[model samples]
Target: MNRNILKVTLLAATLGLVSGAAFAEDYRQNPFTLTYKNAITENVVGKVNIHAVNYALNGVNIVANVYTPANYDPSKQYPAIVVAHPNGGVKEQVAGLYAQRLAEMGYITIAADAAYQGGSGGEPRNIDKPSHRIEDIHGMADFISQYPGVDATELGLLGICGGGGYSLKAAQTDKRFKSVATLSMFNSGLVRRNGYVNSQTDTIQERLKQASEARALEASSGEIRYTGDAQLTDEQIAKLPFELYREGFIYYGKTHAHPNSTFRYTVSSLLELMSFDATNNIDLINQPLLMIAGSKADSLYMTQDAFIKASGADSKELFLIDGATHIQTYWNPEYVDKAVSKLTEFYGKNL
Candidate 1:
């Protein structure tokens, strides 16, 4: 049997007969990247209201991109949003698009490069820490309000993928935010440690074991080995469980390749994600919430589980885009109008 087929078969078997692979799966599709030449760019633009503002949260320098609405005004304050990007992603990715789009909708939006990745500061690149990541949201709120056009009182938070998970985590404790929302919100701790919905009973244990083993090697040789993303061939890519990855190479490899994006994250730090648990404290959040995901997203279940768990969430709604997959929402124009409209309505009503 071919390796691709073998891998697919094994993954399907591992997922059991439940068809876990079928949820509006867009994991293979790369969400559209922000480019100046694109037609849409003319609709959305950003002024460097703040550049490299350093927030020493968890001993890392967090960088943020703040975008104000088209008509400038320092005389009056406006609602603000703190947007966090996806895992292994940067500020220039999909989060920036959402931030800019929301700004165009009349809100001051700030997109940040999570600490230890992209433009943010951290020694070992791509180490995901639960608390630190949550604080990054708060730090973004802190940094953005200082800008001239933002209203400190009317605040909201948005996160995509892993950042979505961290946003959920942030909202639990920081009631300072008037409204909280997520796009394809993933429970970073659960998925990173358990492989989506507690499926891998030993994921955390196994991850810890591997980290321990890697530490021993570093101790002996003073050399660190980071396990990065699994590189796949075209043949292997064709059989990816999540089509998003297969589609990703087309964008990341050709269209969006950047000098700083060669990052493959440290393998030794995979265990860091195992320590994060955003859902465990959902009962503490007391705010209006909106959870949006494609009806077909395999990752949709995680959002469902989270929306159900959050306590004191009387003002909450879960909206699913029919026929849309997880990655397609990133920037396909596939469902951008619907997603953006729904968001505008939600924010317009609550904020």
Candidate 2:
């Protein structure tokens, strides 16, 4: 299918106007439409349960899932963690997996869809602006901190993929997060502005000009242009240059696909994305920090660069999942287990 047709299909699915055996097959096991392995099917007494939630963020209705620990008690205090989803990802994917996993480890955790993406409310859909993305993390912190039984003073953060970069920016000024962590950290701004591995450095100005034109077009005629909305064939996906993109397609497009998740973002968003860098104010985060990435991930350099520049962190550590790739850290059983174990250790001590 072409990009425009895919967009129409997505819009139809979102509006409940489309349904098929594929949708039924994908979501039959879980009423919540959670795609993770071993997802919670229902709320059982004295067991981990997920609460679907929606809250207003600057007039946009942000959709999220809050996972309460087993035998959760409202009268008692518990540390909370806010989980940010990856770019083009929804709360029901890997973010929900980690949130549920962390809740199982005895912390109240939340995973929310970012504004203009996933199930969240926003116009000019898929804006993908850095400022809005960073605020989504803060909004999650705000809501989760006030949840029943939550100890407002004890809060942690976990960002995956593109969300990792926004989390870094959020933790810089949002001191409410006492502990911060990232898995398979991806610097979205760096990659977007400079292209993956700086391969598009020569075309930076040319692309910026196109973004400017897109913005102008939108302003004058209310027309929105999108990018990165391609539907690639399996053979085409296999030929992608980067392992992150190659494996990512299999993860997000097939095995764990959710109708709400997508890659399309307004082309005009590049106006803001090109000027933003996650590591710009790295020295502002004074909390304990832990960053984990796959040792073999093509994206490892991003984690290493950010780790080295986090000079203001009270303490910091970089962990590598042996023999794992970037996307593997998201869902591979061994890698996910390793990442979660380290996160439990980090948040346990810090939060």
Candidate 3:
């Protein structure tokens, strides 16, 4: 059989399958360079890193990484933050970057791969349901809060991209997060249902029919169909229309490529994702909230819209990165620095 087919077949056999080839001894080495800046290495002097941590949540084993401040001691209490990765992302990308940076700033932070994706245990992998994603955030808070030296009362949350939307939902009832922050919030439901920028408004019913078919196939355990899974040539990528998808391909697929991260999600996931909206029940979140997005980012509207609807929160602010786009805020040093700075200040005041 062809390699790609073999890869998919193997993934379907079991949950938590690391994409491509057999699982490695250490996910931080060889083909897996977990961090964007490669900040983590063999000699971690002052700081501490615990990787591939397994924890049970919602009947699945979650894999996460914990980063602690220098001279970390379990006896002492310290503030903590749980970072949520973007959609189609694992914990190691931008989420790890933020977690490590926050750890450097004297906090215990964790970045966990969502169940059914990355190294986490889940069947029919890449399920990508809203409830599952939201639960992942709650689960992170559950495990990290129990970690050594974590001040459960001073916990904070930072959600990036699609994770941001789910964070809002999670924070609504999961008051364990004293403060909530989202960077480059992507309204997955709105975009999935109405299309990117509402460009597919004309095709809503048509796509729903397609999704229904996908769900039917899934029930029978038939051939699984996926969406947004593409390997594009450089020329093809350049011709893509939208900045979000175009730059995203380069970021997630090329420069930041991790064996575990893929754009494809089960097409059936749309059944739930399309009908869900992150901004629903916005009034339930009364905690300090900060939403950051690049001014040039096409997804800025989602953040702004959600921010406005967060009427129950007495303390909520929207900060925009001046010249960055959606994906640029992920790894661009200058942009990342700005985002982290705002987050540090926000968490400092709130947590």
lDDT scores in order = 0.67, 0.86, 0.81
lDDT of 1 by residue, 1-351 (tens): 234422332232121111112212232342333421221323333432222355667677777777777765779889988888776666765777787778778888888877777778887665556666777888898888777867888898888877888888888888778888899777767765665445455545655676667667767986665544344455655675654454444334434343234335444555566677778878777888898898888778888998898867859999898977776677667576677788889888878
- Point to the candidate with the largest TM-score: 2
Task: Tell me how many clashing residue pairs each candidate has.
Answer: 12, 0, 0
Better-scoring candidate (lDDT), 2 or 3: 2
Where is model 1 poorest over a 10-residue stretch in terms of lDDT?
12-21
- Candidate number that wins on TM-score, 1 or 2: 2
Q: Write the per-residue lDDT of candidate 3 for residues 123-174, one digit (tens) a residue.
A: 8888888999999999999999999899999999999998999999999999
**What stretches of model 3 exceed 4 Å from their correct place?**
1-32
> Could you give the candidate ranking by TM-score, starting with the highest?
2, 3, 1
lDDT of 2 by residue, 1-351 (tens): 244533332221111111121232254468999988888999999999999999999999999999999999999999999999888889998999999999999999999999999999999898989999999999999899889999999999999988999999999999999999999988888887777766567666776887898899999999998776556676766776778877777777777778888877887888998898999989999999999999999889999999999999999999999999998887888999999999999998998
Best by lDDT: 2
- Quote the lDDT for 269 in model 1: 56
* C-alpha lDDT of residue 317 in model 2: 96
Compare candidates 1 and 3 on TM-score and give the better one. Answer: 3
